[model samples]
Each structure stands twice: as structure tokens, then as C-alpha cells.
Target: MKGRTVVLDHIQGREAAALMVDGILEDFLIASDAPPIGTIYRARADRPVKGQGGMFLTTPDGPAFLRQVKGLAPGVQLLVQVTGFAEPGKALPVTNRILFKSRYAIVTPDAPGLNISRSIRDEDERDRLLEIAHDQMQGCDYGLILRSCCHGADDADIAEDVSAMRAQAEQVMLDPGTEPETLCDGDAPHVLAWRDWTDPAEVATAAGSFETHGVLDALDVASGIVEPLPAGASLFIQPTRALVAVDVNTGSDTSLAAGTKANFACAKALPRALRVRGLGGQITLDLAPMPKKDRKGFESALRSAFKTDLDETILAGWTPLGHFELQRKRGRVPLAEVLK
Candidate 1:
């Protein structure tokens, strides 16, 4: 309970994964009815929405929207990968840049190159990985990326991972299907837990791990509107039709530094709150009433906190009305929406 713990379990018959740090829910994932990110499809190009600068395609699942498309005629078959979860009444988000990702490697069909993750800083280790890459991808044309997880792992395991990804990519690329169909399914929550959560942690995969490790309780709190912060502060995370509105409050304590402290507290806790609740898209933060001079400190705290976060986040600058904005990718369906 004092360290990182990964719990792989089920919630309401859907597979779920939870990452707990010191008995607190740090991240959460659950399956949904919509297509998960990374799903590959052989789709038929449909009508283009020129006004929106995107094209709608037909897939086995449903209609998907691909952005930045040009001159793609209707009825032409091409591969597309799901990039993100769809917003309400929108087409599934798909991209032409297909990537086959695993625990230790990623194969990119569009970007052709062999590279290693920059996090593996040791020169000798990089050379060793490069050697393995050369040997495995001798005649391959697709791009290959050795993930940071390859560091300190067994060479055989790394080799096998790269080989597996390359094979899958080749098979999908060579498929001669003329109709809309699925090429590959996305990794489920439990699989994502192992692939992305690379830090050393105690693993619990028992049937009742969620209940035994208190993930269920933490999830119940995360599903609510109020999220507790340090020094009796709180954040009201409310999702409106347009965006997620976060209102910060300095509860009880009214010290001169209360606003600054509460702002910093919200900065640190906001990522975890949004991650656990699976809330993303436009995020408007109405931070505590702090002095303008403290804005830099608040932004610094926010940047440092989200630096290690898994999902993509763009910290758009503060608004004219003192509100901070963030554009976060919708990686998964909302937890509340899923349960409902």
C-alpha cells in the first residue's frame, strides 16, 4: 500500500485496470462499447466534410472521421487506426498513420527508421539495442522504435517483442481485403496495464484484487464531483456539455498564502482527478484567487506534475479572465458514462 501497486480486475463485467500509488488511485482504465484506441481497420473512404477539413470513412464498427485528408476518393480501401475516443454523436477518430505498439517496441509503417528511446541514455546499451534491431529488421522497410522499457530487459525478450510487432505489421499491411473489416483489435485494459505501466510495482491479478486493494472505494470517490486536495482544499470537477469545468476552493483555512497553496494543490491533484475519472477534452480551470505573481509558480507545478502523465495534454496559456485552459486527448470513455 505504501508503494506502487497495479490491480487488474473487472468492474461490472468489464475488464478494468487500476494503478495505485501509496493506496491512492493514480490511474484507471475500463472497457467500453465504443472502439478503443489503436484498433486497426480496413475501411472504405466515404464522403468528405470539406468544411471541417476531414473525411468520413466506413468501417465495420461505424463511420470514422480522418483529419487532414486530401483527394481520397470514395470507395477506395485503406487501413486506418483509431486515434482517440469519439465525442458525443461524432464519428470515431481515426488516422492513416498506423502504428503497431507492444511492451518493448513500436512499428510505424509511415515513418521508416530504426530508433531507440532517448530515455535509454547509456551509450553501450544503445549500441546493443541497435545491433539487435539491425539483426531483426534486416530487410524490413517499416520503421522500428525500441521503447524505453527495453532497457534492463532480457535481450531475447526484446528481440522477440520487436519480431512480433514487425510480423503483425507485415501481416496487416499485406492484407488484400477489398471490404471494410477489422485488421487488428486494440489492447484491452489489462494488456495496456502491462504495456504502459513499466515502473516497478507489485502486481495483483486475483479475482478480488479490486475490492482487496481498495480500488473500488477509490473509484467511488473519483466518480463523484468533489476531489479532495491538501490543506482542506477541494476541486469541483463538473463536466458540462462543452468542457470540464474545475473550480478550486480553499476550504476552512484562510491564511494569506491560502490561495497560492490551494492553487498549487489543485495543480498537482488535477491530473489524477481527470485520469481516474477518464475526463478529457477542453479543461477550464478556475483556480483559487491567487496573486498574478503566483501564476508562474502554479504553471510550473502543473507542468512538472503532468510531465510523467501517460495521456497527451496541451497546457494552453491562461485566459484573459484568469482561467487556465488545457486541451487533453480523450483517451478513454468517461468512467461515469461507462458505468451508467
Candidate 2:
């Protein structure tokens, strides 16, 4: 309970994975009916939206939207990858930038380069990973990204991962399919747990591990609106149709620094709260009554909190009404929707 632990289990008869750190739920992933991100598809261009610079494509799952389109003739078949989950009644988000990602390596077909992960800073380790990349990706034109998980990983395993990713990229990129098709299925939740949770931790695979490790209990709290914060502070995360509203309050704390304390706690706890709940899109934070001078510190705290999150979150700065705002990518389906 004091260390990092990963639970590969099922929730509501659906495959799910949870990462717990120091007995707290840090992240959660569950399979959903929506097409998973990272799935590659041979999409056929349907029609472009006027004045939107976007084109709609046809996929096996459903209609997908590709943004920033230019001169894509109708019926043109091209490779695209699922970028994120779609909002209700919206086209599935797809991008032309395809990436073949694995635990240790990511192969980029259009981008040609070999780069080591910036986290692996040891020169010797960097050199070793570079050597592995150079050897495995020899004569390959595709770009390779050595992930942070490559640090301290076996050379053979890293080489194998790189090779497999490169091979998959080649096979998928070279396919001559003239019609819409599903080229590659995305990695599932359990596989994602193994792939992304690279930190040293005890993996629990037995049945009902979620309950044994208190993951189910944590999830119950995550699904609710109120998220308890430090020092008797609290934040309510309510997902409305337009945006996620986070309201912070100092509960029965009659101290002079109560507002600052609650605001800081909200800043630190916001990312994990949204992540565990799989909430995304527009986010507006109504912090406790704090001085204007403390805005910079609050912004810094929020940035530091989301620095390591996998989702794409843009700290869109404060609004005219003193509320903090952000735009987060819909990387996963909302937890409530998934569970339902």
C-alpha cells in the first residue's frame, strides 16, 4: 500500500486497469464502446466541411473527421489514426499523423529521425539507447522515439520492441488497400497499463484485484462530484454539456490563509481528479476567494500538477472573471459513460 501498484482487473464486466501510488488511485483506464485511440484505419474521404477546413472520412466504425484538410479529393483513400474519443453525435476524431507506439519505442512513418527520450538524461544510458536505436533501426527511414521506459530495460527487449514497431509501421504504411479498412486495432486497457505504467511496481493480475487493492473504492469516489482536498478543502467536479466546472471551497477553515490553501490544493488535485474520472474538454476552475497576486503561483501549481499527465491539456490562462480555464483532449471516454 505504500508503494506503486498496478491492478489489471475487470470492472462492470469490462477490462480495466488502475494504477495506485501510495494507496491512492493515480490513474485509471477502461475499455469503451468508442474506437480506441491509436487505431490505424484506411479512411476514405467523404466530404469537406465548407469554411471549416475539415474533411469527413468513412471508417469501419463510423464517420471520422480529419481537421486541417487541403485538396483531398472525394473518395481518396488514405491512412489515418484515431486521435481521441468523440463527443455524442460528433464524428470520431482522426488524424493523418500515424504513430506506431509500444512500451519502449514509437515509430513515426512520416517523421524521419532517431531520438532518445529526454527523461533518460544519463549520457551513458543515452549513448546505449542510441546504440540500440541505431542498430535496430538501421537503414530504416521511419522515425523512432525511444521512450522513457527504455531506461534500464534489456537491450534485447528494446531491440525487439523497436524492430516490431518498425515492421508494423512498414507493413501498415506499405499496404495498397484501395478502400476503407481497419489497418490496426488499438492497444487495450490492460496492455496500456503494462505499456504506460513503466515504473517499478508490483503487478496484480488475480481476479478481483481491483477490490483487493481498494481500486474499486477509489473509483467510487472518483465517479462522484465532490473530490476531497487537503486541509479541509474540497472541490466539486461537475461535467456539464459544455465544460467541466470545478468549484473549490474551504470547509470550516477560518484561517487567514484558507483561501490560498484551498486554491493551491485545487490546483494540485485537479489533473488527477479529471484523469481518474476521464473528464476532458473545456475546464473552468472557480477557486476559493484568493488575492490577485496569487494567480501566478496557482498557475504554476496547476502546470506542475499536469506536467506528467498523458492527456493533452492547455492551460488557457485565467478569464476576465478570475476563473482559470483549460482545454483538455478527450483521450478517453468519460468514466461515467464508460461504466454505464
- Candidate 1 weakest ten by summed lDDT: 47-56
Q: Give each model a TM-score.
A: 0.98, 0.98
Task: State candidate 2's TM-score.
Answer: 0.98
Candidate RMSDs in order = 0.9, 1.0
Model 1: residue 68 alpha-carbon error in angstroms? 0.5
lDDT of 1 by residue, 1-340 (tens): 7999999999899999999999999999999998889999999999989688888999999999999988898888999999899877989999999999999999998999999999999999999999999988889999999999899899999999999999999999999889999999999999999999999999999999999999999988988999999889999999987999999999998899998999999999999999999989999999888899999989999999999888899999899999999999988899889987
Q: Which lDDT value does model 1 have at 10?
A: 95
User: Candidates' lDDT values, in order?
Assistant: 0.93, 0.93
Our tally of clashes for model 2 stands at 0
Cα lDDT for residue 38, model 1? Answer: 96
Q: Give the total clashing residue pairs for model 1.
A: 0
